[model samples]
Target chain A: MLINVPETVVADALRGMAAAHPELTVDVENRVIIRRDAPVPGKVALVSGGGSGHEPLHGGFVGPGMLAAACPGEVFTSPVPDQMVRAAAAVDSGAGVLFVVKNYTGDVLNFDMAAELAEDEGIQVAKVLVEDDVAVTDSLYTAGRRGTGGTLFVEKIAGAAAEEGQPLERVEAIARQVAGASRSFGVALGACTTPAKGSPTFDLPAGELELGVGIHGEPGRERRPMMTSGEIAEAAVDAVLTDLEPRNPVLVLVNGMGATPLLELYGFNGEVQRVLAERGVAVARVLVGNYVTSLDMAGASVTLCQVDEELLRLWDAPVRTPALRWGM
Target chain B: MLINVPETVVADALRGMAAAHPELTVDVENRVIIRRDAPVPGKVALVSGGGSGHEPLHGGFVGPGMLAAACPGEVFTSPVPDQMVRAAAAVDSGAGVLFVVKNYTGDVLNFDMAAELAEDEGIQVAKVLVEDDVAVTDSLYTAGRRGTGGTLFVEKIAGAAAEEGQPLERVEAIARQVAGASRSFGVALGACTTPAKGSPTFDLPAGELELGVGIHGEPGRERRPMMTSGEIAEAAVDAVLTDLEPRNPVLVLVNGMGATPLLELYGFNGEVQRVLAERGVAVARVLVGNYVTSLDMAGASVTLCQVDEELLRLWDAPVRTPALRWGM
Candidate 1:
């Protein structure tokens, strides 16, 4: 059943989340962050955001050890410059604030504009744009490749770097390195329903799946006949591995596209582990289930990160967001 | 794609859960719980259990402000006396242990047997049997009306009472009061696939929904033609409100049956709030989302509790479990 949702009501969902989780606060009027307690004067703050619908992403990732602020846009659309500007101002400490953005054209332009706005206010600002999705063929133009699953890994590792008191430049550099070292590929078993349209964002036959699909319900490189779980895992992981051929140990993520069950995710992860073992890939870390979702789409994505010693250390650090809390 | 799952793997799933959440230690060999520190010295411990397949119910609810141990059974099946006895021994402090049990025939019998075993060990024990589901008509003989959503509220309130260093008798009394004041009813939009069976646990046509469905995939009170979201919410909330007649301030939980999205749950909550407001029922707290799920069944349940001042305070207390954490 399709329900027509208003474009602006996307913020209502974010407000609902903020109301439910008091540990996090939102600027409903200005799209800023108030730190639940607001105005932490001494800490080096970090702010990040992009499109909405990849929930528990930037919003759920906001807390002590991760992002200090997240500016959200409409569904699958980049936040406007005003939102990022407010978010930057709200989380800026004397040390400086860093913005982690996905390398999409709209997001890059808006965040760049916001960075300028923050700089004009004498707030030291740095930006690290993630462009880790390997599915896009041409990197020279058209947003120069899109950011996808690797954004979370970058967020966690970079958040840890910042939490450890790294300088903004070093943290931004580390975030960029993580993004450069990661690759991802996804397959959509069914198209997602846009809240505004209530119908599917795209259409696929009952027996077919879209391979290498984008997170925004964007069309993939190809659509293929439905295959076994093992086959799907092979295609996704193989594509990622081919792009980032790292012999070093890696972190593997078998992420759900929102609507898939954890049970099925486990099955998909089992297939991933089996294939990686066959390829003699050394897996240093593994995370399964919904980390970044595309809003009720029946699909899964595989992410591989070529981890160095530094990356591994950052990955192991404590994180205390509403969604991904570990260690402390 | 019906996949046949082995029934024996249900226990394995529980073991996996214990492994996943280090906060709750599990005894795979004995199916028990000792603290991560292995046995708190002198506090009176609490243990609870019932059927499995209700992810994060008995298992997820086991934590600091909740049960000290939970004995999970086969999929939708009751745990044997041996499992419950082991759980009892592992959690038994010198002060004694309280068993918070739902009042199903199998659950009562098994817990009773376990209590007797504890008595033989010279370990003091008490039991609070919960029968809060209001859907069943014959509560006198027919399995005492089948415990449902109220199990969560009972556990939370009773857990708080126990945390306050109350004696076993008082804790049991509080639990019983919570059970008496709460009522719930649910509608299943679709059947869940049992992991072992690989197929759905029940059959429902595309347009039909089963009302008053049990947490363990038991047949609901009735199956009627599927209706709109407003209609379903009306039926579920009406059943609960009629049973409890909660004229006082209440906590309303619109819990997903497992697979329903937050989008639909929010719509359902809207209907629930609208109906309760029209009926002059004041809602003190509202919790919507998948709290107690039946694997991947697509449906939701409405639970309303008539809270006294004490109960309301307890409900507002801090909890730090993996599933439900707030005010902490």
Candidate 2:
């Protein structure tokens, strides 16, 4: 097990992120990472959050032109409505706030409660649920598609639209558009060890694969024997393609599951590209790294988002968050 | 063992990086990642090389404000002079070129030979040897203080200066200055698996630690039982402080040795800052994460560079590379 965390794991780690990045304002009491200068006038503020183990996701993503604020839950646990209420209230401009909710039951419930909480206090709130994981139709903790890597696309594209001074409806529409257009599939070599559990969430015998695993270590469809990188890429890419066939000018992301080294991730990206090319899907823009991850789980996920000129422009817009930044 | 890389791992991964980042042009035969707009006329080009597994290091680091070209050797092996010579020739814009050679023996020797070869070919070359790891006066792989994370500082500060149109001599001098002023210390909780070996680099019994571990899995000073995060922070901080006491403002980097999740790193960063605050060393700036890493080794290193305003300015300068980017 590779968890070497301290007491108050989530609090301590959040504090560390605040210390490293002065641009992020940490509300220790509320447990949110806020943009130092929030409530950008007339801009639809974006707020996202989930379990904390996925570093740079909800928290590392809190910055200008991306998330106005991020509410982080404990490792692999859903954020409470209190955090969402406070984050939405704190970042809300005159324009309504938008919550980019991932499609997990707990997350959806909490975000829904928080949206109501904000509206009750005379604050307008909207949400665009991201449920892009095509791995399982339903999982242990999710009612439908489990939100995975495609959340990043929603966050980035919607964040850019909001930053461009779009109204609340326009930003929410962008989020919905991207959320519906993207699809992802993941394969895990092993399970992640949560701090609370002190052991792997599940066990996989040697040379066994946990195909289509969830970000929170939820069980996938099968326990197949180990497959070559080529086979794994083919399986994942085929799954994504079967769900939604992206034409030319696709954006591909081969993301690592924490413990996988960049070398392995890059190699996986090559295999992914090879499979996509063989399938006649052109990868116009590519991103390979650990954007979304299960803590210390050695595996990767492939995300393909069908993008036209507008989506590409929004995706390529300047993003200065801690995790994903470019074209600034 | 976390590694599941493709055949010819380094070559395949380098190709993946080339595909993802169009700004970078990879010379497959030479195994070098080159900046598309190399040899910025009248500016000193920077070249760095090392083993492949410490990725993004001499490779992910090649971009506009970083190395003009990076020569990657086989996993955990020093790059040969042939790769470095070709890189130097390709990136040299007639103002001349500088090499950021790590202190490892093979790396040093290869870079030295490349410098000579480049000079023979009517190209001027200068070198700044990074010897920042203070864990040992001599190591299994090096004759002197072995270079570690401080090489990144040299590369960035030097890269910014070069991009600002600094001449070869000035860029080389800045690199040398940064290299001299930085000190690093790393501890490993486990060993890495090389692709060629297909197993761990070494064995560390459960709960036993490898203090002052090298990036390439060399033995350290001791193999003691596991220590608390606080204690680990204390030992690493004390070692760096004893080596070079930062008077007021200092830059602290809590670098993770691959495999360690971002949560653990952030928690470690918190511990480090707590220790520093206790000792009253003002942290002017901080950077945490895996910049240089051993492939999937679960551990971290603390690097402290006593910085003045100039160094801080150089450090904060805009860098747009695959691995590190900000302030653009």
Candidate 3:
């Protein structure tokens, strides 16, 4: 509703980011946002990117303790290999770079090619794929499970590790560990329209919701009659708990998909807490709001990551990003 | 979409707030969210609130450098005088308490009553009215201009002043100054549905937009055919710039009304920046996101706060709220 035109949406948004945040170096022509303090000597640099609509995901996350750089593609489309390669080269110190790629076909293929190109340029590159959405094993844009809210977890924890001067191998391992320990489940109350499409991506009936919905409006497990927040929380928590089976305290993210207000998200988080308590799941920390999103879809997703002491400490470390910031 | 029922929505969200922010004491029964470190000795306490649907306005702003306490009412309803009185008593140290009231009739009346009641209890009280909306001189809920995005500026700058151990008189003066120096204008592409109504609050035809929309679906200046983001920005910035006509650098807030995505907000912000630059308004800071909001309304508001050195310093102070946090 607030765009000048479909064709210039990404560029316009990039210009806004550049203007809003002078702390970061935004390359509008190349579609990359990099922390001005990039190429920190002997620090592992974390780089991530994907489609543009899921804000505060990659671009807004570029700061002191998060991604060193991010490549933003058009809405619901993966960034090309050039953007990733340029980002890696721009931010890579002699210590190397870690690519935090979400699990989508186009993203995975492009990041793989970018990794090879960066390696050819004598810059060490490592990749960790986040496929934590437990909704479906495969989806329209993904060969395996899709990446959803857990991308925030992976980037944050691993970014802290990198900021602490962890070697590339250790940083990559931490990112992969976070991605492995997290699982996500989503529900869509209404479909979101892409700028290019200019219409709802999928038809959602008035009185029903999509259970286990994908972030990009992909089909979920099934469509069901609207459920109470408690019922939805029970279903969502059960889905993640069954797959994750956390043996330690967990970090929880009650994420809104673009259009859901914080009022609804907080209410949903209360119900989520109730369900987790009933199941005896110890929660180490809880974050509620729209961090990862699906454009303007009216929905929410829950991501759970089992956290040990080390992971918890890293999670609590200082982060200064546009979307997520705490501590110092 | 995530509520258990219309009646339990506010209470349920309070429970969620309790779960999410243990640093804030959430009194579910009293509908007051207070910072755990309230009533700091020799420091003036800042208190504010209004309707509940504006999630982060008062509730999410409760922390060290923003609001000491926030009294949340039902959706689009004024918080009762009792809530404000209790909040004042609970948070008032030896220094006193300041109430930041929006200019809505209900809010003004209730806060006035609250101030008297608190003063009767041996607690000193001060009040500042925020009437920054430039849409109209009067509205359905307000006699003067309706308060909008500028409430954030008042709460933030004044909160910072109070945090600096300012006296009640000085803090009140700062808040009133901020409220007076700010101007706001909003545009809504769609209306928001209340939980109780279970439907759109007002009918906004698909191709039309409401210029200068109020926070609670109140009638605006006029309705017009849908305009591009640039056109909307021009109109919104002009409305504010004409009224403000600032001679100094400004702090800009491109706030989303509930359901607008960050993508659109950023794109709109770019146009806002262009317009401001062309108008010779030197922007010292730009914050783009949903700060003040209606419930699930697809819209955006522009707020301009003329800031001098002191006000800008207060604006840049450390704020550790759930919604707005920076510096340390």
Question: For each candidate, what TM-score against the reference?
Answer: 0.81, 0.98, 0.99
Rank all candidate structures by their TM-score, best first, as comma-separated numbers.
3, 2, 1
- Every candidate's DockQ is 0.19, 0.56, 0.85
For model 3, how does the per-residue alpha-carbon lDDT over B1-328 read when each residue is reduced to its tens digit?
Answer: 7789999999999999999999999999999999998888889999998988998899999999889999999999999999999999889997999999999999999999999999999999999999999999899999999999999999999999999999999999999999999999999998998999988999999879999999998999999999999999999999998899899999999999988889889999999999999999999999999889898999999999999999999999999999999987
Which tens-of-lDDT digit does each residue in A199-267 have in candidate 2?
A: 678897757888888888788878898887778898899999999977647888898888888987887
Considering just the first chain, candidate 1 attains a TM-score of 0.94
Q: Give per-candidate clash totals.
A: 2, 0, 0
Clashes in model 2: which pairs?
Answer: none
lDDT of 1 by residue, B1-328 (tens): 1011354354444443443455668666665544464245666677888766676677667777677788877666678888777777777667778888877788888889989988898878888877777777544323667777888898888877776778778888888888889888888877876766766878887667788887766777788876766677678888887778875798877787766656455556666776787888987887766677777677888888899999998888776665666555
Is candidate 1 or 2 superior in DockQ? Answer: 2
Task: Indicate the residue-level lDDT of A264 in model 3.
Answer: 90
Q: State the fnat of model 1.
A: 0.03
Winner by TM-score between candidate 2 and candidate 1: 2
